[model samples]
Target: MEHSITVKQQEVQKRLADLTLQQSRLSMIPGFSGQINAGYSDGRTNDIVTNQYINQSIFNASGQLSMGGDIFNWFSKQNTIAANRLDAESNSFLLQKARNDLAFNVATAFLQILLKTEQVKVNEVQVHQTLSNLDNTKKLVIAGSVPESNQADLEAQLAQDSTNLVTAKNDVILSILQMKAYLNLGFDIAFVPEIPENVSSLPITPLGEMDPEMVYSAALTTYPLVKSDELRIKSADKTFRATRGQLYPALTIGGGLSTGYANNFYDRNMKLVPFGQQIDNTFNKNIGLGLRIPIFNGYQQRTAVSKAKVNVYNMQLNRDLDNQKLRQDIYTAHANAVAALQKYNASATGVMAAQKAYDFATKRFNLGLMNTIDYITTQTRLFKAQIDKVSAQYDYIFKMKLLEFYRDQRISL
Candidate 1:
């Protein structure tokens, strides 16, 4: 017994499945940046600073040497990171919506399957009752209390009951199969859901705690859709600023040290110094500064600024629309949940009465006080009541979940 698997081990397959799904939504930015540059100038390698003793020209106005992010590049990079995270956020929202829908649908259908199974049991009992009645009727016919013709009628009735039981059994089997399919589970291992004992015992209509304004506010300020749009707006603003940066002048300042030798430890410019003299030193130093502003570049930066502004406006409109939709959804769900819960509570009494009627009719028919058709009529009524009661159960459950979805309470399976 001690060698058996742990609870965590038993749940390993489930954990992997959940991880795989979450991983699909998860996204990460590199958190990485780098820049590299190398170049050479034709003359005076040592003069790397200016009159003010400031550093100059590690960079140049020389040949075209393109490199990585200056300040504009850095801002653009930050914007890109934000954009990627927002995209992941929006995707996560959609996945959450799907999860809610799946949970609601499974609960509804599973309840239906349970109700249908109960119905099959009721019908099966009726069929057996009819079979017993038919056998007795045959014996009575032989004893002359009923005529020979009654025996034939009894047998025909028995045959009909058998047919109906077979059909009902088929329905139960089909329902179970559907429940298995919805759960994404294999039917190799039999699964049976525990049905609720009484519909009246379920939660009643909940009072509306949120108004339309609250729903809209939450959607605009807290919902993933609005957050994604806000991220895009921030990115667009950064892009606009970065593009405008091209209009301003770029400033650079640098410095360097160099030493030269010409067949000896002496600079060519310092060649006049006597050999073997301490004056024959070979060293140089330099400093500089540079500035360049773009006069024009075929209006590319202007176009980019325009596009960024347009995107900002478009996103604003989209976010507003999303807020409106969120409000409408909450209203609908709240109303439905309230109505369904009340209706479900009211339907419980009908189900009880129907059950009593079916039981009474069955007893009366067996005691020779009621006909087979009367018992069957009661059976149909009971079936309808059961179906209605189950339907209301699911309707209430679905609406409750919908309410929970709006409240940001959807987490547990």
Candidate 2:
């Protein structure tokens, strides 16, 4: 999705390009200009009147070249460039954070599919067991060892188990679709994620003992999102400094050269000057410096500076907020991992106990010492215990992975 969809990645690329263009604009030579003009006039315009000593209409050609730099404005321009560069760097990190976030999301969705698939298998096993029990009960009824009235109840239980299996299969399908949505895959694209045959359980006590503060500190140094926030604060600081430059004066120096030809000017001999000689004789040069003091700009500069300062403050708060969130998430994940581990252990115990009870119930039912209602109830409890075990096991694993993620660890099954 990050590489192909390009929904988020293209935005980052565009921002980077914009910043780069701004940097280029800032580094450009301050002021360099040249111009050339050629014209023929009947001396009708006041500015192009024929020379007073001559009577011919005016014909003129001229050119000029000038170059200069804004010494004072350069400071502000360079500072603004530096600020934009920092912003671009921050966005680079943000892009990395975005991709990381996407990976985590996809991983979570994939885990959901795996969990749901396991649930479907569990449901299938329960339905198979229910059908077997129904068959044994039917045979018992035929042999007159049990009442026929029990067959209907057994058949109904079998039907309920089969319905549950169908629901479980649909759950798996829904989870798969959710995973596909995360991948930005088309509905027509079929996908089946690879899962290990078994996932070994990890000890949650050590994870619970881990310090959230330590994990948060590690994450702040390691995670791109944390680093991106820090960079944003720095970028805003630079922008604030750049905005202060508008309060200062701007200075520049430049010079120009120009020559013109006129058909009207006369030489020492009192004859009309040739166009080439007129051009040589009418050449001129000038050099000067300029300074622009910013008396006032309707408080626009002040407003910009104030806004930049506020942005800096906001960015600082954002960084702090991220830190707080990281700490909270780490603590929450640790707590959930501990709780899930306990639940899983309890479910495992329940499954064992239920298995024994179901075995006993089976023996009793086969011997005509137990009723079908009680046997079916025992079987349902056993199935529920097994499902709970699966749920808790996956829950614990996911929580543990979340804690690891907070510590800047990769999440993997």
Candidate 3:
């Protein structure tokens, strides 16, 4: 997940760089352009003074250097630059949100592995207890203190307990594999989940007192996903303004230095003028400002303005949707956290009761007062209670972490 997030971050960074480049290009002052041309021409004309037909051929060359810049269009250029800058900021927030989501996923997967490992431990303890009970029952039967059928029941319970333990171990392996998959690691990974040995000691905000409204408000301001949406809406607004600027008259100031040469011209001595002399004689300079008022352009500008408005509206809707989702997630996580905590507490009480009952049953079974089937039933109940406790503990932890995630806070064990 980390590796994938890094790759996505780089992509967002590249987009930011491109937007920055666009901003720089748009903000720059307009510069000059140069053009040069050479050509030959042939023509015929009647010389009215001589009243006769005449023909002449001329070679011509011209060069011009001009400078121009947009004077005014209601600040369209500035608005475009602003829009691009906003887009870059939006992507930056988007990248952070992506990273946060990936981190949350990894944390959730790690918690699952921890829970499965604890279940495996619980299963091991159950197996050991069943094995001990089986040995005691066999000794009792050998001494003729208990029936032979009692010993047979003990062996059957032992087999079942052993199978449960194996299944539990397989669950641990599968959970580890799931975590590895989230991390994008290979199956051969030597994965180990780090969790507090005493989860009850870990400090967590009590869900009963947590205010969903407060959390949602904080998330609206601090969460990158929410912030990204806000920035996108701002970008769309700027773009819309820029697009509307196109409807106004555009003005540009321009200046040019131009010269031309024609070899068919005559000097003072009635000779064809030299190229250099012709250029100097024809040199021209001018400065002017141009304005364009949009009368009609097949409604292109109107269409663009309408589209920009729609974009802004869509972005606003998206932001609202994100906020709604965030609220739903926080509320749901808080509810789950509360439920899980209740389950954890109930499971703890059940474990105590089952333990006492199992202890009593074990003594009775040894003295041949309780049958093998009854003892096995009590032992399985204890195992189940322990398993439930482990599950509830991890479930509460994950739900708490999920709430933290929505609050734009880092999740920790």
Q: Among these predicted structures, which one has the highest TM-score?
A: 2
Candidate 3 lDDT, 194-271, residue by residue in tens? 766776786677785577888888788889878878888998999899999999999988899999876656765767
User: What are the models' TM-scores?
Assistant: 0.55, 0.84, 0.81
Off by over 4 Å in 2: 1-18, 21-28, 31-68, 201-209, 255-287
lDDT of each: 0.58, 0.79, 0.82
In candidate 2, list every pair of residues with a backbone clash. none
lDDT per residue for candidate 1 within 146-171, as digits (tens), equals: 55665576567667767877887787
Task: Compare candidates 2 and 3 on lDDT and give the better one.
Answer: 3
Q: How far off is model 1, as Cα RMSD?
A: 11.4
Instruction: Give the distance in Å from residue 153's predicted Cα in candidate 2 to where it truly belongs.
Output: 1.7
lDDT of 2 by residue, 237-269 (tens): 878887888788878777778888766566666
Q: Candidate 3: misplaced stretches above 4 Å?
A: 6-14, 17-21, 24-27, 31-68, 147-152, 181-189, 254-288
TM-score of candidate 2 versus the correct structure, residues matched by position: 0.84
Backbone clash pairs for candidate 3 read: none
C-alpha root-mean-square deviation, candidate 3: 4.8
